[model samples]
Target chain A: MKFDIGVILASGHEILSGLALTVLIWIAGSALGLGLGFIVATLRRYGGPLVNLGLAIPVEILRGTPFLVQIFLLYFGGPFIGLSLDPIPAGLLGLTVYGAAYYSEIFRAGYQSVPEGHVEAADCLGFGRIQTIRHVLLPEMALIVLPPAVNMTVILLKETALLSLITVPELTLTVQAIGSQKYAFLESLFVLALVYWALVEIAGQLGRLAEGYFSRYRTART
Target chain B: MSWKLFSLLLQASGMTILVSAFAIVAGLIIAIALSALRLSGNRLALGFVAVFVSFFRGVPLLVQLLLLFNLLPALGISLSSLSTALIGLTLCTAAYQTENLRGGFAAVPPGLIESADMLGFTPVQSFLRIKVPIALRLTFPTLISEAILILKASSLVSVVGVIELTKMASNLAASTFMPVELYAAAGLIYLAINQVVTLIGRFAEGRLPGTGVPAR
Candidate 1:
């Protein structure tokens, strides 16, 4: 009948380890998603109509369906296709692929917002194609892309909780296990909610700081 | 892969649609009320709405559902798994919809409200006839996207024991040992449902008044 903070504190060790795993997965997933997303967006932009169509289909399917289903398909279905993976690897792969679909869309929008004039201007100069992309396109895209990309990262962070369903031993599963074993469902869940809330809040603040840092670049360039 | 298994998935997709429909409608009503509370000049009401939005939006839906699934029994309020799932989804989507509605309302021109006031419309009349409609028009596309989001999110309900499309696929996969076929089929069904939602949204948007297009 009473709420007990002690219940959560008692499982501090497990909670800490779970938190570690959650952060690790989040960072790795974000890095991979961003990198892979950039590649896909580049291909979509320059790969011509047929290549764009090919890339677009998978991205749309990934965006359209639930992450839970996508992860299930990969984790459970992988074995049938001779691509078996352990739970953590499977979860990481799912998160990366899922996050990439969103990030790629963001990048594609960012690319569109960069004017054709800028590209043509870059072409007039002696800059190589890769140099033009590196020096001109990416800088322009970064300003527009940073906010949504951060938003997606926060969303992906929350998604780490879903990895618990596939038995990834992240924060959610850790708390659930503690709740069931210790008979402190309310307290454990309270802790789970608090931890997730704090994580998302921290991610948002970091996003704002990054935005500020990027805006400084904008002002300096001008 | 079998016809019977596919039928089961289809039936489960029906449940997914039903649950999402209830949540989206219920969420919109709650979101509108919450938006009203925010707009109202009462400090206590505004504070309540603020905290409600932050807590619901800050916490992930899965965690919210699990919290309700566990906390409800502790409060001596026993609910079915379906009820728990519905409550969680409705509350979660309500927070998001409230944010969208606030943005929509903010975009409503000040001139229109002032015109309504000069025309001697009651505050309530002006709100219902003018504000709500404009805000709904502005927020329509976002609302449709939110609807699709809730539909995909409904897949999480299976954790609480509701056999939605995703859950049905997992169940069939385990039984038939055909995870590839079952999950792919489930994914395709979800895509089909969302495409239908998108098409309907586009049709409704074109028909919406004041968009310079005539309704059919």
Candidate 2:
């Protein structure tokens, strides 16, 4: 009944830094995810159906299940396999791998959405394979892909909390530490929730901004 | 201890499947209701539904599940672990599904609804017969995707010691000192069940024939 402002504010200040760590993990992991997604998307497109099937299988399996178990496997189980990463690395690895699966789909959609005329025009202009992809295909897909990539970034940010379970010292873990100490489990968790809400809202806003700016750039190109 | 451990794992997997079944049913009802309320022409109801969906969908499912299982007990509404886990999964799952339903519902052109309205179809009648069927058809793949996502999320119940497959595997690993093997087996089980579900979905879509999607 007596939840003091001072106690909550002080604990909130301590846990606020967890947001920075969350963003850092998201940025690093998502960059890795994007690279892997591009390769997977390309392979799925031109590498034929069986390769697509192989690509699809991992995405389906990872997409179908909850990330919590995947994080657990990475966090606790990695040590048994001679790759004894700490919690942050394992958590990042798990989310990055999972994100790659979804991002590949987004990429494939974007790649397909690029009008055939654009690519053919590049070919007519004497651009070779790598040149066409680098100068033409990538830019066009960027307009379509940027929005969902931002969405996936927002998603991976929230998934970072699973890292807390294995003691990654992220925002949720920090909040959990305070909660268990004061036994204000609800208040402490409520704090985590609001922090997460703000984090996502900001990321979403930035995503919209990026989309707007990118669209303008594409329009200017024409 | 090994025999006891094996039995505990079986119990946990049973619990996992049971809770998942409860969640899928509960979530579908809540999602359909929320989808209706979204188009209810009531500002407050629409606003409330929008906030509920984004809030649940924004946060990680693990965090939401944790709050439900652990926090409500402190707020003087204690439930058993199974109930807490079920409610947690249902709430989050429904929130996510509402958007899918809304999108599916949205894909039915406004013209179609207007046409039905002009034909003297009452709002309720139009929604039930025209909107629901078409929306469900459009959203079949997305719905399958959501169900798979929910099944994965059921693993979080293991964290609160609800002893699902993940929990069972972890327990067996600790007792047997073979963590990797135990988790691999558990992962395989998950992958297998999911593949079955995917196949069934494909078969169902094949039978429907005119649902506007090709079966994968």
lDDT of 1 by residue, A36-125 (tens): 999999999989999999999999999999999988989889999998999899999999999999999999999998888889999999
lDDT of 2 by residue, B1-216 (tens): 355655556666677778777898799889888988998979999999989988898777777877776667656887888788888889998998888888778777777789999999999998888888878888788777777777777888877767688888877877787777666667766776677778888998777646443422
Quote the true-contact fraction of every model. 0.85, 0.51
Task: Kindly list the per-residue Cα lDDT of model 1 for residues B1-216, writing each as its tens digit.
Answer: 789999999999999999999999999999988887887769999999988888888888999998999889888999889998999999999999999899777877888889999999987788778877878888899999999999999999988899899999999999899999999999999999999999999999888878222222
Off by over 4 Å in 2: A1-5, A43-61, A115-124, A217-222, B1-11, B109-122, B209-216
TM per prediction: 0.96, 0.88
List pairs with backbone clashes in candidate 2: A65-B152, A66-B152
Give model 1 RMSD, 1 decimal: 2.6
**Clash pairs for candidate 1:** none
TM-score of 1: 0.96
On lDDT, the leading prediction is: 1
Give the C-alpha miss distance for residue B172 in model 2, angstroms: 1.6
